[model samples]
Target: MFVDQEGPDPNFSAIAAVADGRATVTVTGEVDMSTADDMLRAAMTDDVAATTLDLRRVTFFDSAAIHAVLQLADFHGPKLTVLPSAQVRRVLEISGLAGQPWLSD
Candidate 1:
């Protein structure tokens, strides 16, 4: 699945794929209030044993994005893994979520 945002200073997109009971969501562009819901929706999948969020291409991330990630972690527990970009890392660090177990190296 692919999601594309329209009418924005920073564009956003998310692609989700499932294989072997695992879901992988690769998100590019910005993740903010305008795109957080889409990000969450893309990441959520039924019957998946685990989910990986690849945000290495994200150029912007905000509190809303953090909330979306937290919600995913709450739903997926230890099964959720997030690979954050540098932009995301900076915000996560400021939010004190950088040490979260769900954040992958």
Candidate 2:
């Protein structure tokens, strides 16, 4: 009767992975109430700019996701590139990242 936590929930099947040689994290899934923290933490890897977040397939986002974006900026240095979904972009904008030095795209 025990469940596992090592796997992603079906509803949040989307994955946020590093790409471009770990210089970027490609987010291809729903980053909402459940996956927000995971997404944010994923962006804290290395190089970051080499980290081009790919949110081309994200379907939804919430306040938690927005907060995560804000936190991500702190790690992105001056080359934080964001490939956010329409919704994710809006969130970043509101969090004051659109014009910040952390945003590259």
Candidate 3:
């Protein structure tokens, strides 16, 4: 699926596609207050039964991003999987969310 953000800020983007009963969302650039909604919209479509978030390419992820992920997990249940980068993992660790079942190593 192709998700387009409201504005043209190339610094932040999220793309999603589905295969094998999983909606894989790859987010790039920064996911802050300005871009969190876009990322959420990209990842949490109507068909979010089995979602996998690929946050490996994300350079920056803040509380807003975490909030979005948590919201999606709440809506989608245990099927949410997250592939986080070192930076993303560090942030989740600092925030005490690294132990969450949805976040993967």
- The local distance difference test score of each candidate is 0.90, 0.64, 0.85
lDDT score at residue 10, model 1, on the 0-100 scale:
54
Clashing pairs in 1: none
2 versus 3: better TM-score goes to: 3
- Cα lDDT, model 2, residue 30: 68
Say which prediction, candidate 2 or candidate 3, comes out ahead on lDDT.
3
Rank by lDDT, highest first: 1, 3, 2
For model 2, residues 1-105, the per-residue Cα lDDT tens digits are 534454444555434465555555666666766677777776677643455556656776667777777676666655566676677677667766677654546
* Position 22, candidate 1: lDDT: 89
Which candidate, 1 or 3, has the higher lDDT?
A: 1
User: Candidate 3 on 1-105: residue-level lDDT in tens?
Assistant: 535466435776798898877898898888877788888888876654588889999998888888998898897788889999999999999999989999987
Q: Give the clashing pairs for model 2.
A: 23-50, 23-51, 24-50, 24-51, 24-52, 48-51
- Alpha carbon lDDT at 87, candidate 3: 92
**What tens digits encode model 1's per-residue C-alpha lDDT throughout 47-97?**
899999999999999888999999999989999999999889999999998
lDDT of 2 at 9: 44
Compute each candidate's TM-score over C-alphas. 0.89, 0.64, 0.85
By how many angstroms RMSD does model 2 differ from the true structure? 5.4
Candidate 3 Cα errors over 4 Å, as ranges:
1-9
Distance from true location, Cα of 31 in model 2, Å: 1.1
